[model samples]
Target: MMSCSNERQIITNAGFLAVVASQATAGFLSAIFSIIVLRKCGNLHVHQNCKILIVSMVMLYIVHSVSITILQTTQLIRYLTYYDPCVVGLSTVICFCLRLPASVCTTSFASLLFAIVFERATALWKRGKYDAYGPQLGYALVTISIIVSLASTFWAVQKVEFDQHSVYCSTATSQTADRVMLLCFLISGVNIITLVGIIALFIFNEFALSRREFDLQSSYQLRENAYVIRIMLPLSIFQAICYAIFSISSGLISLFRDKLSPVQHKTLYTTAY
Candidate 1:
């Protein structure tokens, strides 16, 4: 017969193992999907510029997914060793490993989504002249995203702390950290709005294009652009929805900081995940 403490330890180990296994599975599936998209983009009969942007997005997604999985795996090891499970309470090295990449990945994803919106919008509005500047624009956006996301990462890592009784690491303990979380919520709101607006614009453009007549070559080009957008729109929408849920939850957590128990905070954070 197991003692009480032993039973509790068993439960904790099982929970941590479940989390680690799920994270690993998610990362594997995401990598597989990204690889397929990468290869398919190469073979796609789409504009070269669109292809470049799509492939780049896939690459970023892959990197983000893999980084998150690694972070989770690190947490799993920490639990196995009976170290602090909360990221905030961990040593600086573990803290950096867990938070920095996550911050950068989150911000970069939002930026890349906006960049895609720009590319698709330009293609729809400008029609034929898109290839002239699309790839250049995408590259510039990606570079800028990396820089901005790094800045956000720095801001988010400011005073992370861990509580043994708490559900996870707490970053909103200080006023500055609270402000940083608020900023994240604001950015998330922007992502949702921009994504929704992009979808609306795409629908309008497609309808307008359908009513117009063009030369066979121009029409073919338009169709190709539309095809690319159509294939990518669902992905954009899925990301936007996830972002919306995360952002709204973060905002609520930030707003009701004093009211939420650690378990509530953990639940919200998990939902965001």
Candidate 2:
């Protein structure tokens, strides 16, 4: 059997490095992606609302990447140098440090995507007048998304009791701590719905295009909606996969945590990270 201290040593040296590398790579790619979107979409004259939604997503990705990198790298150095103990679940301090901000960015991005779907559907109800939609509507959707994200995030984590001074950490804390899984489940569910909603919107647009002819303006709007879906679907799929893994793994850990051995606990937490 491995000593507890030795197990910690192995994970700190091996795992944190991988975590840091992944965050750095994610950040770099997000920055490049943002630049490309700005350049290409500017040339294409995509509407202000579409630009706002796309830019908001890229910004969230960049922020999430930076925050995770710093949090992981700081914890990595601390564990490597004997300044912080490596716990099976993250140390309370590290979890507290990264939880809120990262979760907010994640929640906000998904919320914005949902808003896009809602806004497009509403625009269609406006029919020929959809062309008159203004940037204020875009701003309003973005504002609503941010507010809802903040509210949902607070609601999800309300039960997690953080002890800033405690080095001890485990899968089980307050009985209410299991509630954090709510956030994971909610985000995962929302992403899945976003995926389905966007696909349906695209299909509807294609069907409309194929069947009856429309005025030049309505046809252009329909085609534009479909084009936006093409660009956004890859992102929807990626987020869906990411959140599904997070929610499933976290749910499993919460449910079976009592049965897991120390090594199993550590392995699950590390992978979920």
TM-score of each: 0.76, 0.81
Residue-level lDDT of model 2, residues 157-222, one tens digit each, is 665655532222322245435556776678788998999998888877788778766787677678
Q: Clashing residue pairs, candidate 1?
A: 89-162
- Model 2 deviation from the true structure expressed as Cα RMSD, one decimal place: 3.9
| lDDT value, candidate 1, whole model | 0.62
lDDT tens readout by residue for model 1, 215-238: 554566567757766775676677
| Model 1 residue 17 distance off true place after TM-score fit, in angstroms | 5.4
* Segments in model 2 whose C-alpha atoms lie over 4 Å from true places: 1-41, 83-97, 165-176
The model with the greatest lDDT is 2
